[model samples]
Target: MKKLACTLIFILLSCHLFAQDETHPFTIRGLIYDEKTNERLEGAVVSSGDNASAMSDKTGFFQLRLDRKAEKLKVKLVGYEEKNLVIDFDDESEVKLIIRLTPEPILLQGVTVTGEHFTEEPVVNSYSIHPGDLSKVPQFIEADAFRAFQALPGVTTAADMSSQISVRGGNYDETLVFLDGIPVYNPYHLVGVFSMFNSDILQNERLYMSNYPVSYGGALSSVLELNSKQGNNERIKGSAALGLASAKIALDGPLWGGNFLISGRRTYFDFLTRMIMGIRFPYYFYDLYSKYVYPLSKNNLLTVSAFYSRDALGLDDDKVFVAQKEIPNWGNLFLNFSDEYFLKEKSSVELKAFMSRASLGVNTQVFFTDYYHQMGTTDTTTVNNYIEDFTARLTFNSHPDGQALAVGLEAKREAIHYDWNIDETDLNGMYIHPLESLFFDFAPSQYSYSGDEFYLNAFVTDKVTISPVSELTAGLRGSYIKNLKTFLLLPSFSFSYNFLPNLQVHLSYGRYFQNTYSLKERKTEAVFTPFMATFFPEDKENIPYSDHYASGLVLSDIFSEKTSLEVEGYFKDRNNLA
Candidate 1:
């Protein structure tokens, strides 16, 4: 009888302990997703109040075991808002959760738009400035992007009449400009007095004065990166402005479950003069820009961008003094298509295809009399310049182990055509150069060239935080130009250290290469007519390149809020100038 009672008591005690264990599992399971796209998000970390944490797998699934006293859980991921939840321990059951996080980009330096206006934010880089603040500065005819650049350090304008900028004592052609992720061979309008970009459409602009990243090549001096705003996904908005020289309008709205934006600008001096005064002003320019964004799926997004600009000048043959008719026209056109895909493993991939073309044409007709007023002659000249490029690029970006890694490949096919012909009589020369060459007459001049070349470029960059007070960025770029059959390896490095809470130091070094060079032509009356020239190997050894070294010191909050003082110096070594 005693043995039976003992066995029963032991079994009852064991059952009670097992029941208590089953009641409090202390385990939580979850699946994370993107709030906007409804796509699974991997690499997210889920942590409890007890400091127990687990990372989501490729399937966005995670399981965590928490302390019995833990009542709160949190989830965190880069480029996403943090999510928190409260646990119900009273339920006494395993907790399963489906958490969604909103996407948020981490910007090192940029502006924040509140309502319809943007607020200027202090940037760590002294060269970085908010594009919206450009309007507050004084304007020459209109708010010009290049003019704003001139206000920055190490940048200078060629003249009051020109908007082109020279950086670090480098020529304008050495600087590169990028709009919406594509290179713009020429980004000027209205005789180089205005930038082609419309300020209303610009979201941000960043200038790298020296030792820029290696992801960009084909420039020896500096880089200007401009990004246009995406359309309003929730509502329709429009803005219009009329200045003394030009009129611009922008419209953005939702379309077909996507978003679209279109902006345009045109100089109206010629139009107004023709309409009000009934006179031929003979000069005008117009520019158009458009972009479209669509989410093809939860993990894929598509975007399209297009730009066109033209400047035209015309003169009649019945002019009073010169009796010469001259027609000059130049324009740029580009189209870009891009796709971004979100992948597992805390990474994303972007693919882009772009087509660009620039065209220049000038035709002249002159009817003149000799200096002695005895002979009459007519001379005609025609010139054409064209550059066309097709480019394909693939880029992969990832955040792994607290470091940012970027790798990309680009292939471009460039074609160029240049031709000129002059038809003139012997008297044409005597009429113009009577004192110097009255007895000698000039012969007809003609030249033509048409060629195409392929280029391949690849780059990789890694940004790492060395310590709490220091960071490092290093990259390398390799480029191969088919015509020259030469390869170039460019490397760049940047390091930043915080000497104090309010003081910092920066050091950078970079090597850059350029395959295209700009040639400013003086054949026309226009002040500036720049044409692009590509490499044609004679000896296959003359490739232009430059090395840049720079250092800067910044002191923040010296006097007031959002105020800082910075001093920087740079040196550039250019080689093989053509």
Candidate 2:
């Protein structure tokens, strides 16, 4: 029996060895550089996808293997950025890269690539934001990815805090952000003045306003997908930049004896907050990000990613009627790893695991007519809101013959905690606080507790070309909320009719939902009422909100496919918010 067991173990070990790698004819080579400074970046981490990795010496150069029928090769590092390459591994290949970094960006995930989808490309209600579009926007000199969405048809930015974005008139929390395959909640800061994400580290930002794939949900209005550069297999690279709030740096290259790449970034805003705010208050924040990828084999790739950020705001008010100091604390963290396995020339599978968490806290103490902390009025109040989402997902992508199909299953769990005081209100409809104090940190809270929620979902979609001139896209998605024991089904489809090769009429519609937000609902949720750093619970008993969405588009080939005019209109609705 012992001999037989040893034989079986030997067989399994042999199989594992065979699955590791396949040596082929060609080798891959490349160079890496700084995207902003246009200088060679040395010590950049570069890897094919797994095991093998090499850092750029003094020259930012790299080299890796290319097995026949090979899959994806990625390169990553710290201080600059990462780059990814998808190639047919039969012959030798060479590529160059420019890594970008700006101050302290929050977190960076993988890039999502799309250009020509046979489904006639939703001509009307959609717009594509490419790496170049980021440069064309006047304010984009800062490379704030989410802000660019505001210029599109259905997008808007929170007027005061520039970072928060709303799609098709939807609420700020209705939107969703995806980094690589992981989810990011509240991807901005200080009423949205700065995007929590750094553009220099990202390769592309795709904003889905009215039309989005079923692979994502839990947000009501739209989806913003950010793609990071895959680590370079050919060489190491890096970059750095300075911004209004902070400074940052990054690097990407190979590992695993030259088969993997690692990348990272860190910001210092706490070091810069000395800047004054008209003597009313002082503000500051900071963050760090890192990613790594390994090429297990030509057909299989592995990756890991992580991020962290923290922000603080302090305000003081001293007048004839009020004396108060308001302080808010916020931050986020995320970690994820994914595997891309190819089954055939046209079919592939992706397995991923990730964890994300965020928190927003406002601690204050008010004063009374006697300048003493009031009982109910001046009582110390603390509103601490935190959200943590852990997820695991599996996806299958196939483009067989004329059929485009994708299927996936995902599970996400969330936890939220809010603690604060709702002072009395006046006739003008505002919470009237009775007192104010110094050295604010919630003035010390009395009662505190937390809440938790979870969700499980499955989705699938397909695009089939019936003929030339016309095509169809159909998809279905459903999510089950473990906390609410509720399930929501979303079905989507789009049609495009081309009267002329350069002219096509398109129509589309879909249902959407989003989780991971403050749940702050007020009477008038417009661009005017800025974030006040207080906790206001929306009347869920009166208005329950779970999801939000929009639908509609236009496509015209006024010029070549490279440059065309597109016009789109959309509408959205939501229920239950605070």
Candidate 3:
């Protein structure tokens, strides 16, 4: 009887302990959006306690699983108000939520709506800047978007006369520039003294020094992406500015159940310099930008945009004692159409088609006259180069239980044309008498080349949550070049861990490749008369590539809520550099 009672007690105690150990686990799924604009918010943090958390993806969706012991859930994002909710896993195994966050008002009186604060970003090597920030810095005549980047760490320019940025230790050509969803080639005006981007029309700008997302390619060093305003959909609004060097006008309003934005800028330095300095300066530039956004349905949106820019600089005859003349001109035209569809609450698809054309031309003539007489020799050279690109891309983004996935397919066709001509005539007596040279015969030399290239690329990236404080991102990209008959595979990975609420560590590795190279003179004498000759790929078995290794530590909220510090180190090994 005693042994039977002991066995029964032991069994009951074991059963109770076992029951307590089997705690119920439930999943929380949600979508976050802006309260005012109803636009999806990316990179928002959702946390359940300190050990369970997840970040929203590009589609503004996130999912987290936690045990029944979790009592409260919190959502936090920069430039927005935070929210907390009570969680009850006992009621259901899964809970779905839609969260709306209100934007925080700026304490400064004259400040506009800037993008998210940089210190709150989870990515260690990424930074965002707003147009309003550029206005605080004193520039030449007007604020410049590209010049603001020079104040950041690890960003350098070769000279003060140029606006081309080199991130880390990479060359100017290695950096990729993007406007909206389209690529921009030669994004500089006035020989790199100013960027093609206008500060007044910019909404936000992002810079990735290394470990960029797989959605961006073709560059070996860094990526610079800029976004323009989508226009006010409620009422008509306009702004105009007149600076010492240039003037700009912008207008936006609702039209036919959609919104439209139009802006234009022109430089008057040709007229200003001629009046103020009494110099016959003949240089001017102008650009026009327009965008239209329409809601096709409750779940779909369409966007159309177009941009055009032209630059001209020349010196007419008799401007100098030698009677020299130079006419250099360049221009860019871009058109883009994009469609976005929300397939589900946590999934979406986007399709985009774009075309870009850039052209450069130079015409130079020099006359060498005899000091004693008006007789002389003349030499003339002309160069013309053109590049055109057409691209189509489709991408899908989804948020599953504990991971985010992005898959994309892209196809591009590019055409290149180049032409060069030179003509020279010598009327000097040293070569021949004036009467004999009056009927002299000379033949000009000419060269021309044309080619077409095709490219196909596919990529997929995944962000996996290891734990509340740890996450991993991995991606693979494959590209095929039809003209070169070559294939390239690139792989990248990054891991981040938060040891404390304000301290984090990150490490990343990536392999990048470039198939096209530009040919231009880099001598100091060519700076004043700069010209881009052509872009071509050499005949070789292997293409140029670079391997990058980077690590960094971030400390947020250092001395104040708005202050942060980041220390990073990177090493790159390159082969077959151009």
Candidate 4:
């Protein structure tokens, strides 16, 4: 019996040894993706030690046979990420894995808004500014987007020399300005000294000094795009401050447990100005902005934006002789609304609508004056003008890699009907739209005129990798421009060369055109001065402009581009409506 027990134990040990030798040939496989985006990686390699290795596919997938003796695996990828996997291949069973890569943290130092939209992809002729760096620049005050702009190369000294702000030799008229998708004809509120935007609430200010993509056209010289804060989805926050011309307060936070972003900003400078200036009456200026964003579902966002501004330069009440009676009644109004909608990510499409009005009227207190001007003969000039624009547009946004892109499209229409009626004419008083004078001789005492314009434009840009040292971007744009009644095309191209890891070289070329022109050409320095609206006998005389722009930016991570001492130059030529 004892002998039988010993033999049975020996048999059991033999069986165990044989089982160990038959170790199951297990295989482990996984796909790699960006942590935040869940985007798959391409061309990644997973090697155990050169001999024991496997390469990952474009989808970041790799399969390696497990050896009972092998223990660890090493992974590497160019320009992206590298990592090591700890595994014990001693088991005979199959192992599945989802490998993760750690992204390299990079400190940015360049133009403020230019680089924020697409960091992964190579953008042509764009400056990327980080708020962290902007906060440290000494020459510019905080929140002064334009001030930061003045520090870049390619910026002309003309405006600075003339004590003005002109970017890339572009006249103030030639620059296109926008804030939170709202077209801002005038970016300044306090005589060019202060921008209308609140820096504290400002998220980014992108400047296309030249060679902007097909997605952005219509402006001749430059494009200054201001992005307001989208509000924190994770927290509620607000700020209030008093400046020289105004005092403002802003509030933003999450709604419904952090699914929605709501924010609002308002300024009561006139009230503060009146208090500080020791004025008997209120001589003030004020502006307000509000925005709400909600994610209806994954990959979809809905946003509502609003703005309001009023400038009361000064007010006066007077009595004038009208034939046989003394009449007294006077007030002026400056009001505006800017709103937009953004849908889709990177392929973002927007519907934009806005209205602006500046009115001055005088007449008897009891008359047909419900937002209407008075017509009389007592040295009184009534100027009333209304402008409305609606645009649906698409924007082309790309990341450092072509794998992600942001594109948008839009349609736009605008109407202008402004009038100038003269009562106490200087007999020879002359008032004309700056452009009208260039085309026709006119007087400030003219009647009202009207104009209607429409535009439709679409743009798409993609980020593509050329090689380890270079990135390429290709973009296309199509447009339906009215008033001239035609379709136009704007194409743009740009590339960046990381000549050295620390130094980046950029080049961009683009075609840009303008379908509309501003009536207020750049002459009025004072607010109370008379405003002259130019008239056109026919809209056909107003010719559309065609322009071409090229630019380059040299960026560095070791130094801030603004203060890094860059040297840039550009050349532009165009024909004015002569």
Winning candidate number (TM-score): 3
User: How close is every model to the real structure, measured as TM-score?
Assistant: 0.75, 0.66, 0.78, 0.63
In model 2, where do residues sit more than 4 Å from their true spots?
1-124, 257-281, 314-327, 361-383, 421-449, 514-555, 559-563, 569-578
Write model 2 residue lDDT over 1-578, tens digit each, in one string. Answer: 23433543453344334333445334455556555443344446555554444454323444444444346666665433456767563443433344333222224235322332212345334455534447556574365777766756556665634667777767666677888767776666554577777666565567777667778776667777787655555456677777655576777665664323233333444443435433433466666777776657755667777888767755433411333454566778899888877553235578999998777666565443334534233434455666678889887765443456677778777666545554442211222122111111222223344666666777777787777877788887777766555676778777777777766667777776555444333333332222222222232233234332333334444443433455544555565543
How big is the positional error of residue 531 in model 2, measured in Å on the Cα after superposition? 8.4
Model 2 TM-score, all chains together: 0.66
- Clash count per candidate: 0, 97, 0, 34
TM-score of model number 3: 0.78
Residues 403-444 of candidate 4 have per-residue lDDT tens digits of: 334355566776667665444332112222331232123434
Residue 160 of model 4: what lDDT? 36
Can you tell me which runs of candidate 4 are displaced by over 4 Å? 1-123, 132-143, 154-164, 257-278, 317-378, 394-408, 422-443, 518-542, 549-565
RMSD of 1: 14.1
Task: Give the residue spans of candidate 1 off by over 4 A.
Answer: 1-126, 317-327, 363-376, 422-445, 519-527, 530-538
CA error at residue 508 for candidate 4, angstroms: 2.3
On the 0 to 100 scale, the lDDT of residue 460 in model 3 is 75
- 1 or 2, greater by lDDT: 1
lDDT of each: 0.70, 0.56, 0.72, 0.50
Best by lDDT: 3
What's the lDDT for residue 150 in model 4? 68
User: In model 4, what is the error at residue 261, expressed in angstroms?
Assistant: 6.5
Query: Model 1 compared with the native: what TM-score?
Result: 0.75
